[model samples]
Target: MTAVVNEQTSYLSDRQCFAILDRASEDLQNGLALRAFLASIALAALRPEEARVLRVRDVELVDDGTGWLMVHPQAQERREKDSDRAGTVRRVPVCRELAAILQEETTRRDLGPDDAIFVLDNGRPLTAQVYRKVWQQARAAALQAHELDSPLGRHVSALRDARIAAWLRNGDQTAGHILAVAECAGMSAPRLAERFANCLRKPTRDEIPWDRLEAALALPEPSQSTSTARRP
Candidate 1:
């Protein structure tokens, strides 16, 4: 939502995230597109690399809004940073919106299990470079001048931060989901915190005790510093 922000280098505001989604959707309807799916997984809290190499078979899009991606950190041919987890697989639940978009993409292309979900204009697999370029274009088109160059969220990976941050917004319950989200994202819980801690929501106006704060602040005049003349 550009209304709240145009973060060029950090996580997106909800409105900006949705705007990108809306733009991606429009682009997808125009023809074969990757940006929409990109937005989908961004909302789903996936790293760019993870989403980049996803296979159709790895994702199951059901008629309902829920879906999940099975991530393999280790596979000689294709892999993620956590691929060395002794061939372990992690499943990350995705919202229905993302599942629906992916379903459409797979169905439209008649993709099989091993087929890469996204491809480049040249029909090669979607690489980070290709996706980055496309994201720049999409962001510029979707955002206004101020947001175009700020840490507000310029890159696609910022979506992961945004999504994770969104989860952390649930307040105390945030801690409970870190391990699960980390597993899904192929990173450890601490790493997840390091990367997306700032995404956590701050206290709202109502949550602040402004009256007490003001009363406390209003109380007293500052005492003057004691004279430090040498007593020699």
Candidate 2:
């Protein structure tokens, strides 16, 4: 007979999720290293080890016009799975909130393409161990301040799990979505479902304010308005 292991786990609540992000954001503002680390996880969806290898060139604003950030894993050699094959790259269209955060950090640090995006106070690159320690400290501080119930306690691994959970809950039910998130996080989809099944919630359709949309579309079209005004 084969032995069986039950390894199911519960998911963090919405309040707990917000508390964690809130705490991480606070810690990020205190220093460049912490901010870069937090951005790696929250925005780039990078694992701690992968984040450790991130250079300034790995990330870029998608276009001069769009406020979206693009994460290119190709710059980091360690992220490559096969020695013969180049590392995979993907573009993540970040929301304005995350874009603003990156903008501030980039400006504050004067980051360049060839520089290491994350570095220690002594101007050294962040190591995997140090990244974990900093994440733990931030988690502990957040928990102590809010007294929130975190299923994974004060572990950086929990943040990865939470990101997967959030992605699944966002109505990304396709295998491609699951696989992409799993691959980026260096985990299997079955493993993710096993660990975060409880966190999967049905997506709710949010009501769009049509009035606001109409008002935005109603803004004058300069070329058309001018042409019409000059019509004979």
Candidate 3:
């Protein structure tokens, strides 16, 4: 799938992202599958199409939290019969939390190598409408009134943006690191940087001098004060 880049894309904070994931996994029907499906995108930055076709054999879970995914390339066109490259795979590391959840799900379901990791309780494949409805319910349950109305966590893709933002803000920003992260997210390094440039910028509030900030709230100097705004 082509990467979608929008300057106005909204992101969820780590807390809010996990809160919604937890609600989806714990409160909704087929919650376990919902959690795994969303976590693949939110935690590992896998595209929805890639995750939809994920098989048990593609996952490599380790006890030391060093698990990784072997993501088969998704077809470029919706009507395409096969992926552009049939056997090529992209690797993505899995977080400890996601690993644990996946472990539990696999064990409980007794899935085979060819079995889809994420499916409905009745063994039916998951559909977009199903997951979207589940996500909306989880978001409503997890967010505050103001947050619900705002753009925060408003779309499923925002979860992937939130993950990439985390890497930019919390991890190394070196060129090599950027390339690695972009590859893992199935995007080009330049596109990733372009799309997430706002994440790389330092917060303006952090650079403001304390005294200057305080002065802005206090009376201005005589020469600097406008006549109409001068204090008594």
Candidate 4:
């Protein structure tokens, strides 16, 4: 059975997420690697452990559109005992933004098929202890003081939660759509629905404050302004 996700899980907004990543890149050593590592979770909805086990060969990057990542089950644990363990893999779509970072990462070291993607400058695997420290520093640099104390962007897993929420919000709430999202996220459809019930609606485009809309809304009365602009 799948683990239950908390319905009230905290998530970072897109702007906040990108800001943190940019800070990580700018402020930390091995910053680009850290940024790519965190971005895989935020953009591709990968679990931290799953992201850890990613190899260069597992990714298929496309410059124009979406790419792909083949995620194995229980990746970190399974890889310990058997590196070649094979079964049905979950294919998560990689957006163009993440593809650029990953491409840079692979090309930086000319990584082989078996080379681990995220590593320290010393070529050591990025350990949880080390990354946790780096994450704290990045958060300190990017987030406001109050947000540092709050649940928002608190843990690395929150990135995955935010990505899943985006998937839920952008897609139809039909059974088929939910199942597809669950497959990519390595969860059951029922579990996904129960956890993210609040995110199943389409975004409101009409609510956006475009320039014309803002101008129309902010138009002064005829007595206040001689120029009459057409309504948007």
In the order shown, the candidates' Cα RMSDs to the true structure are 9.9, 15.5, 13.1, 15.6
Task: State the weakest 10-residue window (summed lDDT) of model 3.
Answer: 77-86
- lDDT digits (tens) for residues 1-232 of candidate 4: 1112343666788888888888888744688888899999989998888898899889987758669998877745354432233345889999888888888899997899999898886798988887777777888888888777777777888789888988877776667888888888877677677778777765478746687877988956575244445334
lDDT (0-100) at residue 5 of candidate 3?
Answer: 33
Model 1 TM: 0.69
lDDT agreement with native, every candidate: 0.66, 0.56, 0.79, 0.78
Tens-digit lDDT string for candidate 1 (1-232) = 2223332225677777776766654554332456655765666777666677778889865556787788655444144443334356778887877777787778877889998887754566666675666667777878878777666666777788777766665546346666766666666677667666564556689988999999988957545553334334
What candidate 4 gets wrong by more than 4 Å, as runs, is: 1-7, 62-65, 75-87, 202-232
lDDT of 3 by residue, 1-232 (tens): 1122344766787788788988998844688888889988888877777888888999998869769999987665233433223446888998898788777788889999889999998899998888888899999999889777777777788788888878777776777888777777777677788778876755477665889878888975566557657667
**Mind giving the per-residue lDDT tens digits that candidate 2 earns over 28-59?**
43355575566556554555655565566655
Q: Tell me how candidate 2 scores on lDDT.
A: 0.56
TM-score of each: 0.69, 0.60, 0.76, 0.76
Regions of model 3 farther than 4 Å from truth:
1-7, 76-88, 201-232
Candidate 1 error regions (>4 Å): 1-9, 24-31, 74-87, 199-232
For candidate 3, what is the lDDT? 0.79
In model 1, the Cα lDDT at residue 96 comes to: 75
